[model samples]
Target: MNPDIISVVIDKLRKLSPEKASDLTVKNAQFITLQSLDLDSLDTLQLAMDIEDALGMNIEIVNFPATLTIGQLSEHLAEMRAELREPA
Candidate 1:
């Protein structure tokens, strides 16, 4: 998992769920699962949208379900990064 993506996830998640703000650190965000964040459905949806906006990719919730660890989510987004890369 890319540290960059993990940082974005932590930053966005912290802003969305301020109660857990302190806990959502970039270093550990990858180890935690989204389900463990205890966010309501709305927060989760907004987090997805925030991540999409930050990454400039269409992130489907199905592809990045709450069951996935944050590291796994980063892996998914990193795959998107590779897919979107232009030929050089």
Candidate 2:
């Protein structure tokens, strides 16, 4: 996973969920689930949209796994970004 992408994700989380973001660290984000952050469904959806916007790609909401950690989500987004850059 790209560290830059991870940093962007962390920044977005901090902006969108300051309460939960305060308790998070870069290392811990790799193991913590979004559910553990106490984010409601709407918050989670908004976060996804924010991430998608930050990454300049459309993330398929249906394919998102709720159990994915921040690192995993960043890795997944990196993959999606790669796929988009590939020629059809």
Candidate 3:
């Protein structure tokens, strides 16, 4: 993903969940860890909503298991945005 997009995502997520700000960072597509953050269930849900609204893209969490790390989440979001720009 682009650094600009990554930076924006991190900024928005950090603003919404400052406690998790320390956990925000980019990693290889499959290696971003989310376990370091103390986010509870509700926080996770709200984070998802905030990310979707910030990026103007719908994130599909149903298919992804609940154990995603911040890196994985970031990668997934970047992929979604890229997919949005591509033609069907």
Candidate 4:
């Protein structure tokens, strides 16, 4: 389940990458080092949107933790995805 969500987030990030921003679009095999992609702050917000769209979760930046890393983002999204799956 976590893997699925992670893949979705990664795919969304890839799609958001500028077509000319090859530097920002790492090969799928290198998603783990996404921070190395050199995405700007705006791109990060775009990433959040992608995550929300993919997970169908409401992700407010103010509610987001300060932890800023690809692995951490994946974990956070996985947690959100799990919560979304729960009966509410």
lDDT winner: 1
TM-score of each: 0.83, 0.86, 0.65, 0.61
Best by TM-score: 2
Assess each prediction's global lDDT (C-alpha) against the native. 0.81, 0.78, 0.62, 0.61
Selected candidate, larger TM-score, 2 vs 3: 2
The RMSD (Cα, Å) of candidate 3 is 3.3
Question: Candidate 2 regions off by >4 Å?
Answer: none
For lDDT, candidate 1 versus 4, the one ahead is 1
Native-vs-model 4 lDDT? 0.61
What tens-digit string does per-residue lDDT give for candidate 4 at 1-88? 3567657756775676555345332243234444566566677677778778777788876433434445556677777667888999
Residue by residue across 1-88, what tens digits does model 2's lDDT show?
Answer: 6887888888878886787777666788788777677777777788889888888888766545678888888888888888899999
Compared with the true structure, what per-residue lDDT tens digits does model 1 show for residues 1-88? 6888888987887787788778777666667888888877887888889999998888777776878877788888898888889676
Q: Evaluate residue 48 in candidate 1 and report its C-alpha lDDT on the 0 to 100 scale.
A: 85
lDDT (Cα, tens digit) per residue for candidate 3, span 1-88: 5676566656665775687566566653245444445556665677667667877877655523457755556667677788889999
Give the C-alpha miss distance for residue 72 in model 1, angstroms: 1.5
lDDT ranking from best to worst? 1, 2, 3, 4
Question: Which wins on TM-score, candidate 1 or candidate 4?
Answer: 1
Cα-based lDDT at residue 44, candidate 3: 64
Model 4, runs deviating above 4 Å = 18-34, 62-67, 85-88
Candidate 1, residue 50: the lDDT equals: 95
